[model samples]
Target: MTNVSPSGPASERSTGRRVIRILIAVLVVLALVVVCFLVWAKAVMQGERPAALEAWTDDRVSIESFDDSVVMTPIDAASDRGLVFIPGAKVDPYAYLAKLVDAVAETGTTVVITKPTLNLAFFDTRPLDTFTRHAPDVDEWFVGGHSLGGVKACMMAADEEVAGLVFFGSYCSNDVSDSDLAVLSISGSDDGLSTPDKIEGAAHLLPADATFVEIEGANHASFGDYGVQPGDGVATASDDEVRDEITDALVAFWGGSGE
Candidate 1:
């Protein structure tokens, strides 16, 4: 009988398999990097970014109101489908969503752009809580945000009383549980932050009646007012157009839902 070491052939074979797996992973990663590069190039370098945004924002305007925990910047509209915009991390709520407010108002719906604490950053739900407390008779209330603001919207939808939810340049994670309410998920084609795959996945996070829209060649910054200014350098879309498209879709969705 020949006695073979238990750690000899078996270990060698295991190491070989491990090496092959690692090589495969490396190749997959490299392929992904290439694909990402191509997407970025096509969406950002060669796409209509600033001009598209400017076309919408050139004639934008807004109105404001001073609430307790929120300075509501309502867009010009005549509809009853109310919308409350929550800004992204480290951004000024009212300032960033001014154009959005105006756009929603133009659609005949009321809009309130909130100003949260700490310049409206993070996934804080306290602002929503405060707004709910102060304005108890708004009739209808929809919540939406950018980046972390999206997360907050999900949180609000999950626990708080909201008519709907909207996400701009943001993703709805698996943590959301608001399936009964309406949802609208929007993203830019060039938005590296929130990819189509992620945005598509968000559909599952909401009810079966949710809606999704993608703006080709839009960047993460363009989802906010950054893209509105001519030389803002924050994104490719102008603030006016971005907000207009967003509010239009939101109004349509909200109105269609009939809730």
Candidate 2:
């Protein structure tokens, strides 16, 4: 018989090497994709310092920035009620200070604005205590957010310590219609991102008694002081107008008393 030169073993070795090389190449490509995604996610919309400065200087409310959250408390008489507010996707936590300052001052409700992981709320998987822990004094806690952040808040509304839910130009994807949690859905009439129709469509997801408010001429970006967003509607309502409406709604929702 003619010698085959052990060709079978050689062929098997060559095939195995090719497979290894292919797997290495795939892994390298996957790694690069992950890196690019993280880089893009980290690039976030910065909050306007001038507007944020207003909140910092306000004597009525005290603002404190921590590694994971920004806490705003009323200087005179703080309320037992507190809110854990999450920022919209890619928005800086400070962007909300200006809009929320009035609420903190008027309601005396401690506001904790969270710095979500990867600058996006959906990526943050921590429990409610992760933020509420900052305000050990707060007895009743409400969770809220803007846009995508509101969706994340809805997910956490079921927590035992959570007393309510608030949305700013956002709606819940998960059903909490049966839950007795007090829910507030605030939407912008001129919002191009979370359009009026979208909010109305998702209305059934909230509790039957959920309160809804529409800020006329307000756009998606009006909810924060982060300048104009790329796909947002033109805001006919001035910043002051939006702020007043939001503050009023919040006060009314909490039974017109922060205490």
Candidate 3:
């Protein structure tokens, strides 16, 4: 006699039930992903980078071509200091030139502003590895960013090789609060997104040597060239004024080429 398995209506019903459960689970997972995508899309900024300004830059900063699509290399090769910047979520890579190239570029520090996936820095925090491996000429290296980019840079600042970390209207997420690396946190008094209160509260994460500077009347949206941010406060300072202040503080912290 040969042993046989159940092959009747009862077995068929059980198999059908398992198949239905699997399909429901897959559908639930797909729905969750869709909801997440929807939320992300709603937060996306639709501003375009004002590229015509690049032509006016003239000889100030020579925009260099690199192998990585994730970075915009605006190099002032005369300087010894280098900064790898991470752009804020939904902001264009070139938009950062408004602040960085205008202020720090002339200070003799070459700046590389990374274009993160969907303009979100957390998605590609380590893209600077490409430049670090290839650019041996830069003796001093710093990692910096605006908003979410700054928080992510906190993680990179832990590297023994990174000389310092800079934040523009941003704060660290307690990751490098105790790090010995030099930290410069700049916030705008009018920035509603990264409010002065929040930035002050985050000071505990920074080392004793960390420097925090607040711009008199700048807003979070002014940190980049993009138009007004959704939840930003009105800025009392012109872009030139705020940018200049930020550059001054940055140069003081990093000892730029002018130093």
Candidate-wise lDDT, in order: 0.60, 0.91, 0.75
TM-score of each: 0.62, 0.94, 0.81
Residue pairs clashing, model 2: none
Per-residue alpha-carbon lDDT of candidate 1 for residues 140-214, written as tens digits (9 for 90 to 100): 777887876787777767777777788887866645543567778888876666666667766666777677787
Q: In model 3, which range of ten residues has the least summed lDDT?
A: 68-77
Instruction: List all candidate RMSDs to the true structure.
Output: 11.8, 2.1, 4.9
Lowest lDDT sum, 10 consecutive residues, model 1, at 40-49
* Model 2 C-alpha RMSD to native: 2.1
CA shift at 84, candidate 1, in angstroms? Answer: 2.5
TM-score sort, best first: 2, 3, 1
**Candidates ranked by lDDT, best first?**
2, 3, 1
Candidate 1 vs candidate 2: which has greater lDDT?
2
Better of 1 and 3 by lDDT: 3
| Model 1 misplacement above 4 A | 1-62, 65-80, 120-129, 132-137, 174-178, 227-240, 256-259
Which residue ranges in model 2 land beyond 4 Å of their true spot? 1-6, 255-259
Taking the tens digit of each residue's C-alpha lDDT, what string does model 2 give over 49-107? 99999999999998888989999988876889999999999999999999999888888
Candidate 1 vs candidate 2, TM-score winner: 2
